[model samples]
Target: LLNSNLTSELLYENFLKTLLYSIISTVPSCVFLFINGTMLFTLRSKPVFRETCRFILLFNLLLGDTLQLAQSQIHFLLSVCRVKMVYSLCIILSMLANLTNLISPLTLVLMPLEQYVAVCYPLRHASIITVRNTAAAVIAVWAVSSLNNLTRVLLFFKFPFEKMELYDLCSNIALILGVMTAEYDRAYTCVLFVSAGLAVIFSYVGVIVAAKSASTDKALARKARHTLLLHLVQLGLSLSSTIYYPLMMSLSKVLTRMVFLWIQNAFYVTFIIFPRCMTSLIYGLRDQTIRPVLLYHLSCRLKVIIRG
Candidate 1:
C-alpha cells in the first residue's frame, strides 16, 4: 500500500510541474488578449483613421493573440486535470496555437512593411496596398501559417514515448520533438529571434528616416516619432522573448532552471503585460478620438449605476 501511494505521489509531482508552467504562461496571455480585443472593438467603430490596411492588420493581430490565449488556457486545464479526450481536439488546438504564433509574427512583420511603404512610397502606396491587395495578403498569411502549424502538429502526434505516458497527446508530441531534435528546435528559435530583431530594427530605422526628412509638419513628425518609439519598445520586448525561449527550453541544470524561470518571468512581464498596458495607455491618452469614445462609454455605465 505504501509503495502504491509513493508511486502515485511521484506521478502527481511530475504532472504538477508541467501544469504550473502552463498556468503561468496562460494567465498573462489571457489578460493581454482581453485588452487587445477591447482596443480592436473600439478602433473598429471609429472612422478616425482612413487607412483600412492598418486597421485590418491590427485587427488580425488581436485575433491571433486571442486565439493564442485561448489555446494556452485549454492546454493549462488539460495539463492540470490529466484529461484524455479524442485525438482530434488535441490536434486541432495544438495546430491552432501554432497557427496563432506563426500568424502573429507574420502580421507583425507586415505592419512595419506597410508603414514603410506608406511613408517612403507615399505616391504609389495607396494603389499598392488597396483593400483587395490587403485581403489577398491576409489570406496568404493565414494559409501559410495553417500549413506550417499543421506540419509541426503532425510531427508531434507521430512521436513515440514509453516511460512517461502523456495524458494529453499534444504535449507528448512537443516533449518528443524537444528531446529528439534539439537542434531543429534551436534553429526554429534562431529564425524567430532574427526575424523579430530585423523587423523592429528596420521599422524604427524607416521611421527615423521619415521623421528626419519631413521638414514641414512638425506636429505630424512628433506624432510619428511617438508611434515609432512605442513600436520599438514593443518589438524589443518581443525580440527578447524570442531569444529567451530557446535558452529556457535547452537549459537542464538546477541552477539553469532557476535562472531560466527568472528570465521567463521577465519575458512574460515585458512581452505579454507591457504591450497590452502600453496599448491601453497610448490609445487612452494620445488618440483623441478613442479617448472620448472610451470615456463616453464609461460615463454612460456609471450614470446607469448611479440612477439604479
Candidate 2:
C-alpha cells in the first residue's frame, strides 16, 4: 500500500511538471506569433517596405519564420500530447516545417550581402540589389530548399511504407528511414552550412576591407559590419536547430527517462522555438524603419486585448 501510494504521488508530480512546462513553452510562442504576424502586416502596410529591396527580403524571412514557428509549435504540442499521425500527413507537415526552417538562415545570407554591396560597391548597389533581383533571389532560395526536400521525399519511397500507415511522430528523422537518406541529410546540412558560412564570411571580410577605404561611407560601412555580425549570430542559432534532435537522441542513451524529458522540453524551447522567433526580434530592434511601426502594431494589439 505504501509503495503504491508513493508511486502514485510521484506520477502525479510528474504530470504537473509536464503541464507546467507545456504552458511555459506555449506562452512565448503565442506572444511571438502575435509579434511576427504584426510585423508581416507592417511590412506590407507601407509602399516603402514593398518597394525596398531590404524590406522585401525582410518580409520573406519573417514569412518563413512565422510559418515555421507555427508548425514547430504544433509539432511540439502533438508530441507532448502523444498524438499519432498518418504517415502521409506526417510527411507533408515535416516537409513544410523543414522547408520553412531552411529559409531564415538561407535568406539571411542575402540580406547582409545586400548590405555589403551597398557599402563596398556603392555605384552598383541600386542595380545589384533591386526589388526584382531581390525577388528572384527569394524565389531561388525557396526553389533550392524545395528541391532538397523533394529529393528526400523521393528517397523515402525506398523505405517499405506499405506496412506501417501510422507514425509515432512527424519529423525529418522520423520520416527519413533509409541509411542513404540520413547520410544525404547530414551531408547536405554540412555542405549547406559550410557554403553559407563561406559566403557570409567573404561578405563580412569585404565589408571590413571596404570600411578601411577612405572613399567608403564610414557610417554605412559600420552599419554593414554590424549587420554582418547580427546575421552571423542568427546563422549560428539556425545551425543549433539542426543539432537539437541528434543531441537529444544521443543524451537519451545515458540519461534516465524523466531527466531526459526535462532536458528535452528545455532544449525544445531553447533551440526550436527560440531560433524561429529571433528574426523578428532582431529586425524589429535593429532597423530604424521597422522600430516605430512594430511598436505601434504591438501597442495596438495590447490595447485591443485590454478593451476586450
Candidate 3:
C-alpha cells in the first residue's frame, strides 16, 4: 500500500517542519496558560479587576484559548508521529475544538455589548450588569456553544469516516470537519458568524457614538474610543479565519501534500496563534488593573532572580 516511488527526502522534510512547528507553538501555549492563571488569580482578590466586566470576559477568553492551544499541540503530536486517531478521540477533539473556538467569539461579541451597556446606560448598568450577571453570561456562552456544536457532532456520528482515518497534519483534520459536515455546517456557520459579526459591529458603533457624546471628558472619551478600536481589531482578527475551514476543504482537494503543509503552517500562525496571543497581550497591556498587577509580579520575580 506504500508509495514505493516517492523519495525518502520528501518525508524527512515534512517531519522536520512538523517537529519545528510543534516546538514553536508549544512555547507560546505554555506562556499563555501561565499568563491566564496569573490573571485568574489577580481577578480573585482584586476588587477592581473582579468588578470589571471586560476583564472577566478576557479571563474566560484566555482560558478558552489555553484549551484550544493544548488540543492543537496534541493534534500536532499525533500528526508528527503519524498515529491514526481513534474514531472516538477524533469526535472528542472535534467537540472540544468547537467548544473552545465558539466560546471565544461569542465572549468577544458580548464584550462590546457589555461596554455599550456601561457607556450608554450608566444609571442602569449596575442594576443590569452586575458581577453575578457577567458570570452567568459566561456560563450561558459555554452552554450555547456546546448546544450548537452538539448538532454537528451528532451529524458527524451519523456519517462516520469511511477509511482508516490516518492523518499526518492538522489540515487533514480540518478537511474532515469540512467535508464530513459540508451540508449542514456551512449554513450553520454562516448564520452564526453573520449574526455574531453584526452584533459586534453594532455594539461598537453604539459605543463610539456614546463616547463621542461625552465631549466634556475628552481624555475619557479618547480612552473609550481607543479601547473600542482595539476590541474591533481583535474581532477582525478572530473572524478573518471565519471562512478558512471551508477554504481548507477546497485547498486539500487541489494542492499537493507539501504545498498544503506550508500553506497550512502559514494559516496556523496567522489565524490560530496570532489572535489568541494578541488579544491577551492587548488586554494585559490595556486594562489598568491587570497591567499594574502583572508588572508588579514580574518585577518581584526579577528581583528574586537577581538575588539568587
After superposing candidate 1, which stretches have Cα over 4 Å from the reference? 1-33, 47-51, 80-91, 161-164, 168-174, 178-182, 214-216, 242-285, 295-308
Model 2: per-residue Cα lDDT over 86-122, one tens digit each = 8888878888888887888788868878888899899
Indicate whether candidate 1 or candidate 3 has the larger TM-score: 3
Error of 1 at 121 (Å): 2.9
Q: How far is candidate 3 from the true structure (C-alpha RMSD, Å)?
A: 4.1
lDDT of 1 by residue, 1-308 (tens): 99999999988976776566666666776655655556666667666533478767766765665665465556545644556765555656666666766666666667767766676667788999887888788898898787666667666655653434434434323343545354555566567556755775686677667767754244654565566566666555544534433443454233454455445555555554554345455545576766787566556655776899
Report the C-alpha lDDT of model 3 over 212-270, residue by residue, as the tens digit: 67432446546655776776777677676555555666777899866765676667667
TM-score of each: 0.68, 0.92, 0.82
Q: What C-alpha lDDT does candidate 3 achieve relative to the native structure?
A: 0.69
Name the better of 1 and 3 by lDDT.
3
In model 2, the runs with Cα more than 4 Å from the true position are 1-15
Candidate 1 global TM-score: 0.68
Q: Which has the higher lDDT value, candidate number 1 or candidate number 2?
A: 2
